[model samples]
Target: MQKYLSLLVLACLLAFNASAQQLRLITGTVKDSLRNAGIPNVVVRVKGTDFLTATDAKGNFKLKVPAGAVTVEAIATHFKQKEIMVGASQTTVHITLNLLQPLITDSEKNRYIMDDKKGLSEVVVTGYAAPRIASGIHIKASPQNNTEDYSPINENIFHTATDQPLSTFSIDVDRASYSNVRRFLNNGQMPPADAVRVEEMINYFDYQYKAPTGKDPVAIYTDMAVCPWNTGHQLVRIALKSKQVDTKDLPPSNLVFLIDVSGSMDEENKLPLVKRAFKVLIEQLRPQDKVAIVVYAGAAGVVLPSTGGSEKSKILAAVDELQAGGSTAGGEGIQLAYRIAAEHITKNSNNRVILATDGDFNVGPSSDGELERIITKERQKGIYLSVLGFGMGNYKDNKLEILADKGNGNYAYIDNFEEARRTFVTEFGGTLFTVAKDVKLQVEFNPQFVQSYRLVGYENRLLQNEDFNNDKKDAGDMGVGHTVTALYEIIPTGKNSPVVNWVDPLKYQQAKIMGNQAEVLTVKLRYKEPQEDKSQLLQKVLPYSRQQIEQVPEDFRMTVAVAAFGQLLRNSAFKGTATYEQVLAWAGKARGEDPEGYRAEFIQLVKKAKLLDKE
Candidate 1:
């Protein structure tokens, strides 16, 4: 009886101790400068413990802490970190952190921070975020050179012809505001937003490219129609198709893959997705192809030396062994991969380096100048590079684009498995094979036929007018089956639209008369042979009526809607008459004949976004 009583007493003591060791529940919402607006995916860490939590879709986080005073830290990309001390009895806490200005201000005494009051004056609402003003960075367009072949088919389509060029050009419009709004919506428990990249959104749909019915080098087609918003403008879509090249037809390929296995890439969307994407590419490789894999994180090393494509199991096994950790040494990895590719250089065959990363190069040679120098030097060795960007949140789009541009390669952003398949499998030739390097488009608007114009997208790809004909200046590359599209929004001379008021009148400049009104725009494309430095030009004229081309097919309209949606997400000034509902309608109408069900999936995404907005 005494033993039983003792056992009961011990049990009671254990229960009391367990209950007294209190666990406090804390809850809070993270916000930006204005307050109350939640920030999503903010990383929260407890100072002394390994415990961490990310804000939910609603920007809310809940954590349990031991019964003692502790410090909580919250960090996010582009935003300042917030830290707070919690007392032993404090069960809940709230915090707000403001986004840091990307630009630095020069003060008389020292470089310091400036409020965004003046910056906010430049905001133009285009449906995504609030307006953002220009960053005071001046982007000069190439001067009008009289060289006939070097001139753009139409200046209005490719250049700003108006005095208020900033107002007309979407590239100069505010993007930070749009991005901020998007972050808010995405964190506010809103459904996955349909913020497809303008370029990718348009490129996702397969336009009708004349397939080689008979023997031909390649087949190409283009569709030009009036932009829905502005009847005075047109959108040009180009499609190129190459004859299927089987494994036997493919030349021996020496391939080097440069991968980032940094700690930031620990998420499933980063390293795991990269492995899966590469696996697809491996399956499509020919037996003659040789592949080498290089990884960078704190240090760079060759994980897998040159191996035959036929040895699929061996390559995949090496891939499976990869795990993400450590800081990114992207420069070291690039150098090592280039060395391997140069060592295995094959004459008259495919030699390339493929870079896969989230573009966070924090550990070594992370500066833009250093990275560009490395890539530029490597490109001179007659080896091409391709950049595949993965993951988000901490993504570096600017850096990735620069690398591909200077490396004589192409750039792609993979948001999911479907994009992976599309880039690696469906469009392998364009993604892997290069046809032309340093492709530049320059347009010369005939002052006689046009008034104001703006080029859409390609904000970072602009070049000097002299650079167009320099041949030495590098530009974008074109793959075997790749298609590049550019859009323009125009305001005709006669239109009385009051989009922007000119600060000063150019009364001294005489308005030119229109000799021929038939031609609305002209396009000039210059490209160089992959191995050559000189470029060849292709020119085409689009008529004015084509600018008003209507009754576009549902598929084509859907494609435009996708691009428009992207512009809206970017808060582009050119996004006139493009609404979320309109985008949804177009997507729904074109969700037919989806053999892979990708279109259906996009439709569902749109619906989800709509439902979230209702909520």
Candidate 2:
């Protein structure tokens, strides 16, 4: 048998009902020996056996070990592996794991150096992550930061604009990636490539796109320009702006705060930050609005029943008194939150469950598929969900991504008090009120003006071309005042760029003749009112006109710059010589308004990322 010399186990016995005689449920909490905080995602299993289970957010586990099993092993990502023995009659045990410092190979040692200027230093993994550097590095990450999961981004390939004239996708208003990436950067680490969503980064700051003037609630804008990286190619920009709604005019809200206070959240950044964030949001609630608080740990329960937002002090007290120290039961919390929302749901109101967590749902129904299925069924009842991410270690980006994407909601990451302010105070209306749902976008390129083209970013937001007109299909949700942007890199016709994929010309027939027109592509948008079944269609035709790169709106160029930065981050196949230097240059020139200073902050981030770029 394999040996683990570090196992430290504690055992205890409790009474059980006679009906439980058929199965012995082994339940316990796992924790780190250093800080005594619960360790998440620890593998818990019967030693030398296939029977196994993993520890949840609070480092808790419940396993149905066979009657004869006595020895169990616990293994965590950055902790020393351990094995512990259970007492003959014990049904519960507590296991603690000692931290394991990674063996520093000569190659790895060369990649990382202590930055005296910063309190904590970045450990650069040459190939897997970005070059990390500088300051507070407060994501408070252990070696476990690198273990978080994110969906791989598959860069779209170029298609002959003639052969595939349609570029269809869902309009994404989710800015989770931008804040998430900022968390890593502020922590002196380059965020994982997949965590950098270009479109979200671009849409993070407000743009000057004109709001809708017609009966439709959304407006579309498009512009084409010479690609900065390769002058031979062109870049197309598309923007969608939703009409702004006055806070007082917005429908009364029915909000449920679904919080995860598992033992993993006991950290300063997790539960503590979450409570403060909810308090900030409480300040924005109107008299007509109602709020409820539901928290989950080893079990789920309501700390505060549905009450008028005017009772702010009572709500704040409930939030302040929350303590974290149990396994996470995310599924139960979600269900209970939905049930609470459903009970007091007001027709036509902004009904939503605001979930704040680190995305470590390790207990029942923890998998993305299971959580998504649960949220999907609940959303049909008219209750939307907004996932607010917190903290870093064991953060499951993919799980939150799926939850927000499938839950008819938006997602945001709360890194610090400032982000919490931005999400709750500055963007209150958009964060809580949805103006349009099932929003979809489709674009058609005139083969005459453009050759092969590739849609930039939106890798996770792409929809099947056929799903565009299908009203039954669930796509994305857009909130009041939200803006969605998409970009396309095109190889203009007759340039014969070698970058595009090749397909043989048809052997049987002649192609359509080109007309002498400046038209490039047309933009089409479909959206339904929050509670409507039918989608309203809106269209705008974009002509192919060469403009002095200087003439394009400053906001348009800024978005372009952000997209380029993302491409550089991902080392995308189509980035074509784009550099962080170029991104900084474009962003600097386009830095216009300073109202919120978001654009200015973005420029600083670019500077930080450039230093972290090994390439």
lDDT (10s digit) by residue, model 2, range 94-204: 998764333233463343222223333323222222112101011223342344656655456567776678888888888889998888777667675567788888778
Candidate 2: 10-residue stretch with minimal lDDT:
130-139
Candidate 1 wrongly placed segments (more than 4 Å): 1-197, 211-226, 230-248, 447-449, 495-517, 546-550, 590-592, 611-615
Give the poorly placed runs of model 2, Cα more than 4 Å off. 1-146, 506-516
In angstroms, how far off is 595's CA in candidate 2?
1.4
Q: Can you list the residue pairs that collide in candidate 2?
A: 520-544
Q: Give the TM-score of candidate 2.
A: 0.77
In lDDT terms, how accurate is model 1?
Answer: 0.61
In the range 268-299, model 1's lDDT, one tens digit per residue, is 88999999999999898888899999999999
Report, for all candidates in order, the number of backbone clashes: 9, 1
